[model samples]
Target: MLYDLNIAWSPSTSAAELERTLRFSAALGYNVVALNHTITPPVPPQVANPLPKFPPSPAGPASSSSTTPDQTPNKQPKLPTVLHRATLVLNDPSAYHRLPQLGSSYDVVAVRPTTEREFQGACLNLNLTDASLISLDLAQRFPFHFRPKPCMAAVNRGLRFEVCYAQGLSSSVPGDAANDARARAAFIGNVVELVRATRGRGIVISSGARGALALRAPADVVNLLALWGLGSEKGMEGLGVLPRGVVVNEGIKRSGFRGVVDIVGTAEREKGEREDKAVGKGKAAAGEAAKEKQEKGVDNNDKNGNGENKRKIGEEEDGGGGGPEGDDNKPMSKRQAKKMKAAIRKAQNAEAKTT
Candidate 1:
């Protein structure tokens, strides 16, 4: 499925606008989209997700049951699978101590590092914070260049770098053309450096669009990234594979065992146990049938009153007896008798010769 990991969201954003953007995204072929709420330092002690939940879109799995005739008439177009995401603006390392707590409140957790030190820390030390995406505002020129060591380090740790194309897109505001041009240039330059540093891997492209107007189709987004020096394959990956990985990784961090093992549900466990019991019973029945068949054969043989029958069965079992009556009265073979007669003749001749 196509994924857009970052769609700008805030308290000031109207529900109508968000819904419109989501619908537009779905129309553009994004199966899943995350609404990103940017949070700054000094996080509140009581972390709660403020993003409002919307009803499942008509195209969603639950839509068949959730939508009714009355609601269908007024229902809007289907929206993509919407997920709540929180992006912590990491200015100081100390500000991110409650990252795990924040993660519990959001479906996905990301970090936007402002300084070189913060960027490096986010890349190398993200495991401690339980953050998945390293979102950089590539529109602004950074003092430090994207180095391979730290970028690859993050990739190795299963972390993704987010490049928001919305930052480079021209705004609707008048007299902002110069700023837009500069931002676009900076975005292109930074993207080239990032693609180089990470060797075109572990990069996720997101719209980061605040409104419907800013979002682009998946194909357009891929082409845009490809023009920015990223390969077409990698660009497609950014929109699909990498972003999906981020969402899935964050989900595991919440629901799985230390993000390594997932606990199976009780129903699933019970089902497996039932299947095993069935197999065991089948094996037991087969074994019992074989044993009973062997015993029945023995009983049938025992039913015979004549001792001859028993003797015949024993001889068959013993691979044919020496004689029908008994082994003691069995006659010797012609070859054995011939050998015995030859020995006697040789002995007589020797005695006579010695005499």
Candidate 2:
């Protein structure tokens, strides 16, 4: 029902308020929760710039607004940082004891905690005990996908969570231009391949949203996805946003990872050809567009002009290859009429030379 979606995080939001927001979000058809640290911000009047700014402040005291972290006058609050790390029950007995409580309350439950071990290297392996396994092996099960970040590739035959970076595709971070485009391309292909290999079990994209602006817009998400040369149709299907079910139906014909990989390679080839054609056409179109814009002004001067100049030029013209019916009119093409008017207007504006 909801094709458009976004994740919001206020850096100064209170924990209680966050819980309320999450509950409200769940009620409002938001299936995913891009978790971040609670940031309790001060109330501001409408029309004011609401975003945080750079250079933390020489005076240190910036806003009249109350911040939960900023309450302590003596200490400067470090920016709240959240990490997506593995938290093993056996390894950490205390966390295991509290798992059910934490898991039930949040919409997007994770098996990790605020730890640093195994955080950077591999895909997070979610292992449940005999009790948790029982839930996993239940006769009827809601497909639970375990998507890790883009660093960790998706696995076959399970509820998979694909943890993709929310911000890097826009800037000079790892997921954007810095990432080797070819290997990243392969990773995208591999991710799709894993989906087909696992059949229709699970495929969820999870955002590791750390800050307020860390989350990506859906349009941007679509564009970054298109950059990988991944199938927009399949990606849409994977995100469960497929309009016509093209990729969903198409996946059925293919069997296993190899088939999906082959399809991806083919898709990439086709995408390259389309891009080449688009580039060629875009250059030609851009040249024509630039010419038109140069002949016209930068703003809404050309399209919606009163056409009084055109009318005046038309009126003064003899219609027999002579210029406008003025004492000193230059020979001009019809296109130059507007330019001539603007020039005269400019000279008249300068007041250096009188008519």
Candidate 3:
């Protein structure tokens, strides 16, 4: 599914406008969209998500056969899957401690670094912060350049870089053509530098659009990125694969144990238990059959008179039998039988001499 991970949201935003933007985004083929609430420094003591939950769009199959004449011809457009996101603006490195709290509250947690030091920290040291995306306002000029070392380091650590197309599309002040042109130039130059830094590996293209007019189709976004030095394949991945990975990783951080292990589903656990029980039953049945066979063998030996003969042989071998032919009946080694015969002969000679 296509993803637009960043769409600007604020407390002052009206519900109607937000709904219209979302509908337009869905119409442009974005299957999933995140409503991003940007938070600045000095975060509140009690961090809570303020984004309102929108009801599912009423654009499914018609349930009623009877249509009223009063029904409007233009039906409500189907909305995409909406997710809540929070973007923490990092101006100082000390404010990074509250990331875990914000991450727990939002479905996706991102960071916008303003300075060089903060940017490096967000790229390399923010692994434990549960933040998945590093969003930078590329429309402004910075003293530092986007180097491959930090950008690729962030990508290797499972963090994606967000390029918001809306920043280049319009100026902050309305009716200012010069500012718009300058912002566009800066955006294009920064995008080229960023693409070269990471080699277009972990880039995620998003609208970051506050209104519906700034939103573009997925194909158009890809083509736009291609113009700015990112390959078509990589741009497509930025929209679909990379953003999806960020979403999934953020979800795992919330639900998984320290973001490492996940609990198995009930169905899988039950299946394993059933297999173990079946194995145990099979082993028990086999053991019982073996025991019964042994008992049957002993009974057969006794019934056939072989058991009595074996018992007699054992008694004779132990010198416990009173029969005269006990020595002959006993099973013995050849040397042992010869020694017995010689002893008997010596005893007979001694008895005859004494008599």
Candidate 4:
């Protein structure tokens, strides 16, 4: 089953409490949902997430008086979904053994560790030491230990890896032609090298979306993959969805399931669009405020200059008009020279910053 991995990063989700979201995701096209441990365990019926999320579907027995079927703690989705034991599962000993057992019920298990040094140990425990892939962070601002050759050779020969470059904190598509090209180029260059160097190992695109409006549709990811020179077929293969991953429910209708997932994402997108408008409005207000402040400062300076001019006129009235002219050969007054130099420096700095 296909699953979104940024579940933990999204608006509200817990490894044990995300049953409803899983149900909805399964109801959509995904066979599984990725969970991150970095996000704290969500609070009660309400939780912390970037996006606003509905509760997980009911796992317990249905009650006639219940308002919705999503009131329970861990209702199983119609299909099998994977629970990634990344940061969360690794911390709790309870999850260490329990997560791997899902392999019996579903396909595509994940293995995460406490440290890079613990990789082998964790992999061995999860029975994935020689398993196929590794998920890497894309929005990482700092450098990471990024060698895949050793992992490729050691993990398994002819193993295919999925590169999950998700949009975590940043939601910007570059603004200009040059900037956009520069940004996309770096991303493509890195992945292309990995795909080429690693040979059998490749990449898969995931939303890594969470919070209020972080998700992008799987189909959108498919389109994004094509832009990177890989098609959906290759991406799915890399994601272990086609050949390696298994479906949890056998009799479910594939078409209907995928349809529901699309709808949920569409809803999330609609909300995001509205939220984006609100953010844009806030920015506009802030810009207007800044402009007003600048104008007021300029006006105040003008008033000060007027006062200075009036004081000079009063001095001339009090004392007889007496003047001494200096020749150009004399050194310029320090005050006059410094003022001119300051103006030039201000202009130069402004120009430099714009570029």
Candidate 5:
């Protein structure tokens, strides 16, 4: 499905206006669209720049009856899926600290760098950020240039560079023709530079359209991207695939554990698992200790039996209880007999002294 990843949505924009924009996007065959709320650094309190909340049903009427089989009365008109996303314009380095807080609430988070310093910070610090659209529309006012190192770094980190086509498309407003022409030129130049720097690897084409008139069909966007130096395959990927990747990665960042593991089971279930594991371990330990005690008792019994056997053998040999054979059996070795006689004499002498 085609995805238009950026559409300016703000607190100031009425629900009717947003509905009109989304209807047009759906009509143009975009399957998914991001409602972009742009926040400027040094955020003003008056502006309620909260993330867009998706409504249960689309703003307009449901699909009406049609003669075509696909559009029958029973069939429902499919409105483009809405996603809540935010774009932060970085004017100060310290302002970046607020992104994590804002990112948690939004489906997708993007950064627009207004200065060289901001651009560097975006590339370095926003490695985990969703996207950073080259603010080429602001090139007429700012002297920021797209550098390669940081751009490639961001690409390696799964951060994409957005090329917004809304401002670059032809404008017939008589007073704004010159400004629009300059914007188109700068946008084309900046986009070309980005494609070359990233080797056409991590670029996404988006409408960045505020209204229906600015939105284009997915085919038109793909063709426009092709004209801007990306291969046809890359163009298609920008519209259909890369934008989905942004949504997926941003979703992981929002819901997953430090973007590493997804949390699916409930807390109660997790606690139960831990308790079960502890109980099992305790049982195993108790069983092991009991087995060891049983084995130790058996060993002690064996040792006591061995001592009794030795005592019986000693009594038979020395206390006239008889040897293993017969009393008549004596040591054949003279030395053994002599040693036995000496031991007997020593015992007799001790008895006499005691008496």
Candidate 6:
């Protein structure tokens, strides 16, 4: 399924604007969209204990049980699933402590490291983060010549590198068209370097679109990635497979380990099965011990001058070792007889040594 994981949404945004953006995104074939809330840090002391509440879905709850008023008997399109996500802009490394708590509160937790120190901390120590965003549009941003070591390290830990395309399209440079053009150029340049550093392994191309106008078709986005130096297959994976993996992994991280295990029975039934297995093992072990004891006692009785249970040693000695043809005597091979004689002589020598 196609996903647009970053659509900036806030409480101040009008409901009408939110609805319009979602409808336009759905029209462009996006099956899932995340309503993103960007939190700039050096977090305020008065900030609520929990993060602000998530924004509502664009069109609210979908009525999938019955056809809509305009639907025909055969024609109906599926609605998109709305998810909540939050982006944290870290200005300092001290803000790392809050990520785990914040991550649990949202469907996806993304971090935008605006400085070199923050970037280093994110790659090396900030294991709680799910996505690493390069927010070059911000006043505070990392340098263009960042090393590949950190980016590749983040990829190794299942963190996806996000390149937001909407910022370049919506450049707000406070000057004439020439200034805006320059700003767009810088934005694209940063994106190219970010993609290069990650080597397109964990890259996710998201619109980061704030409105309906900012949103582009999925194909348009893929083409944009191609222009940014990623191959066609890698671009497609960034759009679909990579984002889906991030979402699935984030869900698994949130929901405990049982979500992955295949334990499907009532509590009482599981308990009963365990107890039954233990009882069967105990019975088999006891039977084996009893059989061994009976054999040992019979041997001891025969050795204690009781001839009733013991066979004649001379009759049993002529290459009469146990073989497949037990009841009938068969001629043994010369090699087999030789080996049996050696074994008997070795046993006699051992008995003589013990005496």
- Candidate 4 lDDT over 163-232, as tens digits, reads 4544422434534565445445556665655565554334544555443244455676666666656766
lDDT of each: 0.81, 0.36, 0.84, 0.46, 0.71, 0.68
Off by over 4 Å in 2: 2-94, 112-158, 167-201, 210-212, 241-355
Q: Please report the candidate that would top TM-score against the real structure.
A: 1
When 1 and 6 are scored with TM-score, the better candidate is: 1
What RMSD does each model have against the real structure?
Answer: 7.0, 27.9, 8.0, 28.1, 9.8, 12.6
Counting clashing residue pairs in each candidate, in order, gives 0, 18, 0, 23, 0, 0
- On a 0 to 1 TM-score scale, where does candidate 5 land against the true structure? 0.64
Best by lDDT: 3
Judging by TM-score, tell me the better candidate of 2 and 6: 6
Candidate 4 residue spans exceeding 4 A from truth: 10-28, 39-84, 88-133, 141-148, 154-160, 168-187, 200-204, 239-355
In model 4, the Cα lDDT at residue 125 comes to 42
Off by over 4 Å in 6: 44-79, 129-141, 173-176, 258-355
lDDT of 1 by residue, 1-355 (tens): 8988889988889977887888888888888888889999889999988876765654643211122322323455676677888899999889778798888888888899999999988888777337888899998899999999999998988888999999888643546888888888898899999999999999999999989999898888888888868899999999888887777777777778888787866644588898999999999999999999999989877786567777665654553534443364555444445656798999999999999
Tens-digit lDDT track of model 2 for 25-97: 3343433333422211221122132323222223222212212333324343332211111112232333344
Per-prediction TM-score to the true structure, in the order listed: 0.77, 0.29, 0.73, 0.39, 0.64, 0.63
Q: Where is model 4 poorest over a 10-residue stretch in terms of lDDT?
A: 246-255
**What's the lDDT for residue 122 in model 3?**
88
Ranking of candidates on lDDT, top first: 3, 1, 5, 6, 4, 2
Candidate 6 TM-score, true structure as reference: 0.63
Error of 2 at 37 (Å): 5.8
**22: Cα error in model 1, Å:** 0.8
Ranking by TM-score: 1, 3, 5, 6, 4, 2
Model 6, range 1-355, lDDT digits (tens) per residue? 8878888887788876776787788789887777788887765544332322223333543211112333222232334666767678888777776766665567777888777788777777776434433333421234646579988987887677776788777564544677667667877777777778888788887887778898988888888778978888888888889888777766666664633433335655588898999999999999999999999998887678556324444334544535543334555555566776898999999999999
- Which tens-of-lDDT digit does each residue in 1-355 have in candidate 5? 7888788776677876777788778778887787777777785534344544443334421111111122213243455667777677878877667777666566677888777887777777765744434433432444756678988987886777887888677542546878778777876787777788788988888887777888887777778878878888999898888888877777666668877678777545588898999999999999999999999999999999999888765644554332334355542334445656898999999999999
